[model samples]
Target chain A: MSAVVILTPAIVAGWPTIVAAVAGAASALGLVVKQSVKQDIDIAQQTQATEQTVEVELAKSEVVAQNLAKEKEIVVTKGDIELSVSRDERGRCKVCAKGKGKTKAELKQIAEQFAQKMAQCFVYNRVATELKNKGFQTVNEEVMEDQSIRINVRRWVD
Target chain B: MAQHDVEIVISKTGEVKVHIKGVKGKGCLEYAKWLSKIVGSVREQKLTSEYYEPEVKSKIDLHQQLNDE
Candidate 1:
């Protein structure tokens, strides 16, 4: 062993990268990507009459974009519960969960869960891409019972 | 050639634990720096005994033995 390090992930990427991560998180959670446009949510909010709405922000995230209009949001759904992921005005990633029948606490919990899963997916994608670019070959990759992702990679250095 | 290995575990909440193996001297630190930049901020880090070993000594020794034959 040479070293052991613990890191906390921060998401800093463009809209396309964030969308890819959102797709990954949605698939992991069995949620469907209902739409990729923010206007869809605006219309749904007007018609759905949601009883409880909760917003959770990823603590360490920044959506870097050259054009403000390109910062589009994504909507994911699992039954009646809907999650809208977008970059807030402060550049932080935000996840909003709302449903008609669920309580405020329930919505909050779901929002938080989605936020964490999204962050996990984001970090996994980033690390895997970087490892491949750095000429490291993956030896093994697996998901633990607790849903954590483990990746082992090796490289030969002369 | 030296084989450098890394084991990365990304927790459900996106926290990462990285274990670097087979790298000697400051080369291990270079890996650490690259991973830190990719993932995020390093919360904690520890260096193991292998990090103090001479990086190319083993390979050089192998080359010298081959040349003697």
Candidate 2:
């Protein structure tokens, strides 16, 4: 490694970019895009009866969480489990998972999975966009060394 | 042309380690900031001396000069 100086990262993006980030995150997290007649996306709010919807928030959120606003929300459901992704009051993106048949632990696990995917998607979208804006073109991007996504970028700069 | 290369390793856990090459001065910070915005919070940052060196000036500068004449 040559003498390359590294500095603090500066984030320059607006709310619309955050929305795109969410869209990209949704795709990375295996969310299926459905056709909607209207502009707003309404989740299939089911469970029919007066069911319990437990909401749990993560306390150990990172400092970078402050870069977000309450822009977009993604609702994911599999079987009885329902998960919602949105940025919390603390600016940290959160995922709420609830279900009728699952125990509290099961719900927690699902929520945790959603949280992980959100984090991964957040990181992926952030990096790719930044590299592009700085004039770096992607050479190769892939998951490696235990499911990690590695991206190689090259650019001509002065 | 001078080539600036970046290698980003984002772990499955959402942690990232970035390696920047062929970029000098404050220009590289642009890439860093752009990335941190996407990836969430930064845990740690390690800056190499190349960051302190003069910006990477491509050989194309000479070609541009010759073309002007």
Candidate 3:
């Protein structure tokens, strides 16, 4: 009753954190992690020349390179669609989707969905850690039918 | 002791909506600021009557008692 606020999440975290979020999103979307490049090894080149490719960049995000090599990518797959998540040269989060027999629009939607899910997982993890450190007790938590997460927390202040 | 309650709803698209209850005045703003820092920039904000109310009811009651005396 006191206040209401709407926020757009900005993803700022280390490479490990980003990878964790990517894993979480992949699991939620029923995708399998095909490859995880933790070191500076050369990633495998795209083998599908005729596949439609779409890239979706997350806004207001900064993926810090702490413990990250010059090149790190997480590749996931769902059926024929392949999604690769990585940080661009500018340290921005990007998701690239490629699938044969799919249109550009379809690939774009798949990339965008993966990006959004990754962001949600990142925000949830950050908020949960902070709330616990701040002595807030979680009173209730649930996932809605729309895949949204709802959490209620309380604390006593002197 | 004052109990502060915060409800956070994170949408599938990663957008967040926060509702703070049982907090008044500047205390409410404190929660809002903390949440915004953890989440991201605030797209919109609204303050209700509770936010405009006195922060400490005990202090107001004490002041009224002194005035009556």
The model with the greatest DockQ is 1
Model 3 lDDT tens row, B1-69: 889899999999899999999998988889889989999999999999999998878543444345654
Docking class of 1: high
Better of 2 and 3 by DockQ: 3
- Residue-level lDDT of model 1, residues B1-69, one tens digit each, is 889999999999999999999999999999999999999999999999998888878434444345554
Using Cα atoms, each model's DockQ against the true complex is 0.81, 0.27, 0.79
Roughly what TM-score does model 3 have, to 2 decimal places?
0.90
Q: Candidate 1 versus the native: TM-score?
A: 0.93
The parts of candidate 3 lying over 4 Å away from their true place are: A38-43, A66-69, B59-69
- Of all true interface contacts, what fraction is found in model 1? 0.98
* lDDT string, candidate 1, A5-100, tens digits: 999998999988888999999999999999987777777788877468889999999989736624488999999888988988888889999888
Clashing pairs in 3: none
Model 1 ranges off by over 4 Å: A69-71, B58-69
Which scores higher on TM-score, 2 or 3? Answer: 3
